[model samples]
Target: MEQRESGGMKILFTGGSSFTGYWFCRQLLEKGHEVIGLLTQKRENYEGIRKERVERLSCEMELIEESPFGSEKMIDLLKKGTFDVLCHHGAYLKDYKSEQFDWLYALETNTKNIKQVIHLAKEQGLGAIILTGSIFEQNEGIGNVPLRAFSPYGLSKGLTFEVFRYYAQLYNIPLGKFVIPNPFGMLEEKRFTFYLISQWKRGNIPAVQTPHYVRDNIPCDLLAGCYGRFVEKVFVQKGPFYRSNPSCFVESQGAFALRLSREVSKRSALSCPVELKEQKSYAEPLVRVNAEPAIFEVQEWSEERFWDDYVAYALEHY
Candidate 1:
């Protein structure tokens, strides 16, 4: 393993095809660090976007199509490679659709595989392991709250955090967990925000099922930049990076949607009527996580600027 000039870290980044993972890779590259991506076989169109971004930036990055769950292969890579940190952003997010046995199996497999990765990292003497968590782990909008994961996907994330924290403490590894809220930006697939924008563009009133149910939405790019800075702080500054309580960075989802709709209307020259529909019988709880001051210090984008950038990007891409 060759050392980089001026102490630049070599990061082993997982989830290369994911939107957040791609943004994180781009930000790390922008900061003059070496990144090697470990991707799965299920490649999406967004992988092309990530590749294009890497090419456009002229940054040298390696994409290896391998499973992180391959314990022997992963251990070999960590032991032999020049990786200083393992930035794990990979996860299976799809729910098991009421298949209890399948969900339990997936949960067990994910937890076991992640534990193996952590053990490998510790054995290889990596500097730090950054786990990208979700706000669903928290019960309320407060810090240090108990886990209240209702869905299978949320349960998986919450359990993963517990496993990561356990290993970090047991092995005395510097582990950082970033509890992400709803991140909206230039996404390859049309999700809630994109669907709303499409409806608005077609001069249709987008129905808001949960108008009162609030969420802390952060722009994907801003979150990625903050994560990059967090990495730099952890490795370069040699600072303590362990956070038992997940840090939440976000804005009101209803307000975010309104701003997005207005921007879409302006961009498309169409009247985007926002219809606040009656709440459904089965409504998801308001996911409001409290933001830590330490986390906010690294993030630069404000709500207004985020909307502006988001609208422009969507108009160009979507």
Candidate 2:
């Protein structure tokens, strides 16, 4: 296996067409690492947008169109490729509430894919594998919580983590896990923050059923920087790295909407009236874990600054 040196470690990144994957790859490239992005040929929604971004940003790195879950092909690539790490960011992301074929899709795209990657990593004798996790894996309630994923999407993520953990323990493979909070920045569309902003841009009042739900928002660039630092730390250390916190504070939906409204008004040529009307009750409090200190820490971005930057990016893009 190729070792980490000044030239940078060779890494195979799955889900290169994902929002998180796109930013993560950019960060790795900026840090002088050699990244080989594995992407599928088909394009849809966020994945399609992410794929375009990766193509636009990554000119030097090798972007291959191949299914990472194809065990035979992946094993062959692992054997031939001089890679130090395998970053698993690919998953079948769907709206857990409305999407059909929930469990079956999750099983194939998430659980099965992870198991194959683990076996291939071991066979290749790679240095380490880093996994991008989600806060949704936690149970919804007030205070510190346990791993109890309620929705199908959350359940998929939870199951994937367990699979990775199990293989890491049983085979003694080096692994790093980082659970990400709500990330906003470039190429982001249809998410809550951006969705609200878009509605306000059209001079319309947005309505929500759950205005009290809390979320920890992190900018995509900031999240990428943290992930880069974590990857470097994992390469240098001998033991596995496991961190649940991305060091973000929880903010309520009502607070977020108000702040966003303020930002929209400030940016508009004339006064942009904004109001969030409450409807039928379906609100649920989201529980986020306290951030534990890590080997590499990033300066947190303030909500105001984040909103300003987000609005600027949105205006330029949209």
Candidate 3:
């Protein structure tokens, strides 16, 4: 049954301070739903957004003021107000494996803390629980690949999805898992865009990596629209909606094909399948550019002027 978007949906969002969460909240607001955001603190940035929207910084929504981590105080907060939806979109993604502290931090934010929030929401009988997942979840480990590094961030996401799946079944709660691929666009803060542009400016990113191996780079606003579709599909579409090329065939062993498209394209050519040529690994990237209506079409990133185009996009948006 298609779940109609009811009026006045009360949503409790955790990790309102991050990039993904920021975009998610903007989408929610655009849908005309009432949202209470929980962030780490009332910093200058938060205050600015809050001033724009009175509800953005309400004490009821701002649980981070009392407790730094939402996992720690989720139960008590739920008891105060019955939320229609709970979104666990907070995560730590630093690009270093040797950093033991980063690993532990990722664990706390992704795994343990999420468990706490899920438990509390389940006990409270929330309408739906959505957890943000990543493409790295499909890989074996984090940041281990030579050209592509999954990082501790990816590992944490993998475990988080597993836990969410297990607990969703255990509690018999309606759940939506967004297996998001690489998302890029100008939204909320352009820190990530700035970082990419900076790398391009400094020639820090290699030419081989300039065009990105994956064509799944989506604009932030467009991504938000996709999230809205997923939310609509939570009850409409059967099971969890894989936020990827649903038509792309995968091996029975869950290894996706990488040779869907050709080696070169006037448009963007993803390294998705090219890089995996040497590894002979079970998991291979597939490009389904067969002209059929794919579940998801990779947005073509201009290869020749990728950096220039990317920088232009960021600057224009900023």
Candidate 4:
């Protein structure tokens, strides 16, 4: 366990049970920051991967379970506790991928009591605020024309940032936007990587849709390291707003799947053969990725540890 000798800021964080949230908070803790995690659901309510995430986070830092963002419990904590940074990371996820996804509903929930949160941070002399952004958001990162959000859920995230940034600007608070691309590693949701491993477990080859879409995928711990470094630097910069779009493995989906398969082959007994389906659907952008490419190289010791942990988790859980 390593720790920073000085500048260990106290941070109020939400969404600790989320995949990236868990890694980001852990990185901060490893660097000696005090993290007070605010979990949206009661401890008992989380099941499956989310449950395991929460349990791991609980043993590491201060956690106020069932304390959703904008809830009375969170408001009370802000009023009573003096924090150096406020990190809002939670979001609504039901039907997030569908065209029927309600961005307005998510917008309302995401921004509820945002003004008060900013106000409290201002009064408490909080050094800065960090809000997680998605590259899928319209006009975010580098991408094809418009950079239109991949789905309604992405639009909601973009709007959510606007609402938070608006209030933070009003108070002249320093705000840091840490834009997330596709982060995959241990304790992640049952997404593309999970699907691949689970199919292998069933002795079936997995097919990748939207194989030609140029996207960004990075190890979660590496992304978390970026977040930790960004926070440490955000306070000193003279700014009303700052942002970092961390990118890694920026390539076509088919190429990325091949990279993943090769990596799995090196570390596990599974050959992990994958097929790339002819991409017919193009609802999302063909090129959408983070603005900052390779904040940390993919060849670090942490990246190796990432695969070790990831493959083990996949084999045991899938």
Candidate 5:
């Protein structure tokens, strides 16, 4: 890898406007790294959460719009790349929670320029290719007796990594896999956390359907902080291949909902309530969580500050 400045490295970042992606970009910037966000969607589609993320991040860094993963445009950018690293955080997320996800299409789209991109990484002297992974994918992380993939999307993610890792090996370049567990925070999606907060705001009691299944839920900033440190470690150490599973809150869905309720109620005026259903669905894994933790630790994290930020975001958006 070639050295440019004395301080931080420049990264070609994808998925900067996504919920997690947005947080990751902010964390990277806080660590003094330069983030050149390559957006997958157009300005018109950058509405709601994406729009908010784009608007805020645009003020902080450079953003190139409408660049899909493994596309001709992205490859062209890589061809002229002067980045220290490539952070591939964007994945095909349409219907990602469904069972009918097209793994083949996603796989093909994710690695269309696999060979060329790896070649470029070597030729351009990029430090490493960091691929964002998922803990729900089969054989990833710890826990989950069998550790089977949660859905077709998980399968697709696992497969995508396999192909990317294969090429990285072939090119003899450094590659790192940063596996993500469930991340929640301010400006996040209307997921379990948001759903519960919404119910509390409307004086409704929310029910957690998959209450019994154990999973990992983490704070977004904490995870991003860990990632920021991970990027630094990548250049410092020799990484033919490496992976980091950043784990935090591990508990049942029902317990997690109640936990959120407690945090929100203590911090805000809203009274939150939750109900844990008799989980009858065994479609997903019963116990699936991450293995590694130190790879993504944010040294400055404070639980109190996290809730403060979380409540502030909720008050504004919700």
Candidate 6:
């Protein structure tokens, strides 16, 4: 296993049972870092854990895989232990469209769980908190973009970012929000990947609106590398606002985060420079190839205001 010679660090990931979560854990473990995983078993259909696979990938690192988001017992178990890092990667995205969107289940789950973890981190004064942010949470210009269709998911991510921001401000803790575009590759769920493979497996791939329009279509390997960097550099840093994609760290002593694209036409005390590499692709049009938008907005506003803008923009354009 390869890691910083300094020694091993204990890390906790809220969602680590499957897909990207599984690989994230694997990478951390490979780096000789200890990982305490929290798996929510709400999805009974896929209830069993692949212990064999986990044991194989875990290698030299310690892994305590269990559900720590549900009841008092679970929370107590989490609180009792200590972790150098606490990452909230656990999210419920069972289906693209569902009636449960009205309930705002993801927001409710993420907010409550993240609050608990943050409180615990504050109490322990752990490293930093890393929350996953999707590109969908961002605005897509003036129309009904495909990303805009992710209303419920976007709302949850927006709320989660706010919650982390508020807590970071109140407690004066180090924090980072990894706002990723579309990250795909290894440990990729066959079901989902198969769906895409099937689509492209056949014939002409229609290019939706050209891929260059998107922001950062990062690969999982690159994403894992980014995560490792965050865990090392930005985790213990002071202040807030660190974007993994464009690479900006807004420390407490620095300026706030504003909207910016690959090209910086406008400047503000709030904006920071971050280089983003673009990719090339011919339209196989399975799922908007290499689409990474240039503009990325960091910082926060009220949910009401966000919803208003989102709805108005979506209605007019979508």
Q: Judged by TM-score, which candidate is best?
A: 5
Candidate 4 local Cα displacement, residue 42, angstroms: 1.2
Put down candidate 3 lDDT per residue, 1-318, tens digits, no spaces. 223367546777766666556667777776766777665555544544333332443432433443344545656687676776767776665553343436566766665655566677767666677777665544422232442324555656777667777877776667787655544544444343445444434445412222222334444555565565555455344453333221222222112122212211122322322222232343333321111112343233233343345435544543
Give the alpha carbon lDDT tens digit for every residue of 1-318 in model 5.
Answer: 644566888898988888989998998898788889888877668888889889999999988878887777787887776678889898888888988988888888777778887787778787788999998788898775677888889999999899988988898777899999999998798888888888788899888899998888988988988888887787668579888888888888888888888899898888887888898988887888886654246666887899998987886787
Window of ten residues with lowest summed lDDT in model 4: 294-303
Could you give candidate 1's per-residue lDDT for residues 136-196 as a string of tens digits? Answer: 6545245332436646666676776677778877777777876666666875456778878
Reference-based lDDT, each prediction:
0.65, 0.68, 0.50, 0.85, 0.84, 0.51
| TM of each candidate vs. truth | 0.82, 0.85, 0.61, 0.94, 0.96, 0.62
Q: In candidate 5, residue 96 scores what lDDT?
A: 88
User: Candidate 4 at 309: error in angstroms?
Assistant: 3.0
Measured with C-alpha atoms, the lDDT of residue 262 in candidate 6 is 13
Residue-by-residue lDDT tens digits, candidate 4, 232-266: 77765747899988888899989989988887878
Across 81-185, the per-residue lDDT of candidate 2 in tens digits comes to 657877888777766654353756775766554556666667777787787787766442234445465466777777777777787777676788877777777
Q: What is the lDDT of candidate 6?
A: 0.51
Q: Which residue runs of candidate 4 sit more than 4 Å off their true CA positions?
A: 1-6, 296-302
TM-score of 5: 0.96
TM-score, prediction 3? 0.61
Q: Which ten residues in a row have the lowest lDDT in candidate 6?
A: 249-258
CA shift of 74, model 4, Å: 1.3
Name the lDDT value of residue 246 in candidate 5: 87
